[model samples]
Target: MDIHDHNRRAWDRAAAAGERWSAPVSPEVIAAARRGDWAIRLTPDRDVPREWFGDLAGARVLGLASGGGQQCPVLAAAGARVVSFDASEGQLARDREVAEREGLELELVRGDMADLGVFEDGGFDLVWHPVSNVFAPDVLPVWRECQRVLRPGGRLLAGFMSPAYYLFDFERAMATGECVAIHPAPYSDLHSLDAAAREKLVAAGELLEYGHSLEDQIGGQLRAGFRLEAFFDDHWSGGPEALDALMPTSHATLARKPEAAT
Candidate 1:
């Protein structure tokens, strides 16, 4: 890898303390998160629709590097047997308390997402990959594992940043073709938060890994055996229309694993 890629990788691995990047979970995000949070702000309700219980009902889910029971609390409430894992002890502790208070049961584990040596193969039906897939150096390795752990026809629902979001990063660039790579977004990860906070994380050694293109995002899923089901161009979570056209920045796609091998 070149020096830029090497520097980016180092910076990315160092962003574990992603302070505020993963928003604190609450009731609204669980019931109809597509309509609730920052994720769906730029799109329509039907654009990125989902229900924790309806879609994940009876589905054994392994939230990949899931922090603070963010999606765990709701899925568990909805009757899905869910396992939450993360490398952060403090985050898991907070999740444990929430699980207990909510009368929900969540199996919380602390470890890395790259190595799930503790769990058996084909042990889960779903791997929730919201905003976390970019953490790995090469996402395919992780996607391959997600495929291994899933039963045939299982789904991997992942959310990532759209390319158009760069417009926000380069909001001022339109004025001058000078296109300053204003932010140090990691090569393939998405740092979706206010600019100031994003820079703060970067300064603390956090680098963003933005796939930067919808085609690349979908290609990863297809190569890993997931069939593209649907896609949304979300400007923000449950908000006004996203009229920015520079990079077509929106939540790009929704995909599922095919039941039959191609």
Candidate 2:
């Protein structure tokens, strides 16, 4: 199927879904990442702390597929200048209203993730990709452009679903565990999401139709000219082990481009 049609449908679904506009963290199968205690999992890097940003002040940051402009406020609050892009006009409009009410500002661009030439080369100091790429059956093209627009020595931060998620889900049980191969150390493309699975997820209250693994998470960044720096595996959910067990699985990766590498 054509990718544009896929995204257009996605935009429609996400806008009508009450979940995206309503909460900071889902009450089920997920915990807040920007919140929560340290130690059930990894702590934020001293550098990536959500607090005051002596570092991000005046630095330009790009938020990819920045739905609802959630992180845009965090970046702007920290003093980083931010530009966010999303395919959904309704979602962006909701974000703009929130920003206006909060007295914060974010530049919202409407575009498909696959093409980002609206921004210049070496333009941003930081590129933020969070919980967004899972929508892409393919992440390489989007990532390549992310690399292109990042200045030499700039940073790329990615928050993506971990491959481990597939193991516990019934997808593995039906395959008699053969589907378990989706998660592995040092990897790339997670399983692709067909439209049926997408529909099921939407029915299940998930705004997104797919999930990705560590390989797709970390490897894609590297392939886009980013060198892996640090990785955080979040197992920290605010609730007890039941919902916590199904809590989102993810890796927060920090990568950088070498100032002199071609």
Candidate 3:
């Protein structure tokens, strides 16, 4: 099965079903952003730090694989020339709706994040990627594509799930009232789940997901030509499982492409 195509349809279904991520930002939010008051999420319930972003005024930014009208609209309102790229048509429509409603100028593109050939090399000054790479089967290619599309001295701000987040059996944890490590780290929807569980997950319109190691997430960025600048951690509410109470479930990083050698 084509994992990317499966995920695209699944997210479209989610968007149609009114998932929170599918909802567009309100006009009031755009107005506030235009007035220089704005923030966006890199992880659940946590806004990315203002310091992590470069100056947005007149910046050329790409909301990498980020659709659903959330971050790109805010960035556009904040004065960036923003382009939002995503795989799901429904998600892209949310961005377009927000742009038209708020009179924000944003370009929406549809494609896989791992293959950014639609955009030229060195096309963007900044790439803002949120917590969606877990949908990808392999993450190194995503990092490399992000590196390829960024200009010299460009910055990348990315949020991703911690590998440990996939270790727990969420259902078991809820039933037992303890975080039970039923799966090993570095899990994949394709390889980790038995046929029955995998079939059930797919039937529910849930995207297949994978847990990439920190080495592939962080070190892979370095390998793709980024200099790691800053990093932070975040946790989900303990609503799903007890894991969040013990450790962070998410991480974000700021990395920069170096200038050409003198």
Candidate 4:
């Protein structure tokens, strides 16, 4: 089966069920954004620093694989020309629902993150991607696509799962038992995990995920024509505080596409 298609349907169902990531932002949040007092998250808990977004007025922003009605509406309200692209129809529908209710004008496109063919090269001033590339099997292609879509000197603010997040046995960790390392870094249910674990995910209709190394997560951007500017590690607050204190589970990066030779 095609991984992207399978994941797309899974996210569609997830959005229908009102999964946390699928929930739309409130009108009050939109109002706050319009007043220039808004923040968005690439990870749970902490808001992305506002300075990363220098100015939003008339900026062309692309929400890369970041849909479900949350960030896009705020960007629109903040005076950006926003385009929200996602792989799931249902997620895009949630963004559309918000746009209608909030009276925001933003375009919604559904496609693979690795191939942003619908967008012209150098068309976007910023590519705002949250922690979604874990759903893609190969991340380099996605980074390359982000570089291609962004105008020279444009910024890409992205969040992703840290490779270490997948090392622990999830069930054991959830049970408050000792968190044992059952898998290595660069994990994947489709290829790296045992057949039983893979079958479990398949049966549950859960989205398949890949654990990308820092090399691919960070180095990939460098290779894709992006210059790393800022980075931060973040913990998953929903989990046990001890686990969060032990180490960060996710990270966000700010990168810039180099301007054309003078």
Which pairs of residues collide in candidate 3? none
Per-candidate clashes come to 17, 1, 0, 0
lDDT of 1 by residue, 1-262 (tens): 2323433344334333444433446655554533333232212222335642135556798876655545566567666788987665655665676577666778998766666788887888877756554445556666677777877777776666654454343435445534444443334333455668656655665444444444556676788787777665544432222334233344635556667556
Question: Candidate 3, 231: how far from true, in Å?
Answer: 0.2
Alpha-carbon runs more than 4 Å astray in model 1: 1-48, 51-55, 164-203, 212-215, 237-248, 260-262
TM-score for candidate 3: 0.97
lDDT of 2 by residue, 82-176 (tens): 88787777667655755675566678998888789899999999887765665676677877888899889888776666655543434553444
lDDT of candidate model 2 versus the reference: 0.60
Please, what are the lDDT tens digits per residue for candidate 4 over residues 1-262?
6899989999999999998999999989999988988899998777999989878899999998998989999899999999999999999999999999989998999999999999899999999999999999999999999999999999999999889888888777778756678887788878777889889898888999999999999999999989999999888988755557778999999999999999
- Model 3 C-alpha lDDT per residue in residues 1-262, reported as the tens digit of each score: 8999999999998888778889888888999999999989888868888988878889999998789978899999999999999999999999999999988899999999999999999999999999999999889999999999999999999999999989888787677768878787689987888899999988886889999999999999999989999998998874465777778999999999998788
Q: Measured by C-alpha RMSD in angstroms, how accurate is candidate 3?
A: 1.2
Q: After superposition, how far is residue 74 of candidate 2 from its true place, in Å?
A: 2.3
Ranked by lDDT, the better of candidates 2 and 3 is: 3
Local lDDT at 176 for model 3: 75
The lDDT for every candidate, in the order shown, is 0.57, 0.60, 0.90, 0.91
Query: Which has the greatest lDDT?
Result: 4
TM-score of each model, in listed order = 0.65, 0.70, 0.97, 0.97
Show model 2 residue runs off by greater than 4 Å: 3-17, 20-54, 168-208, 211-213, 236-248
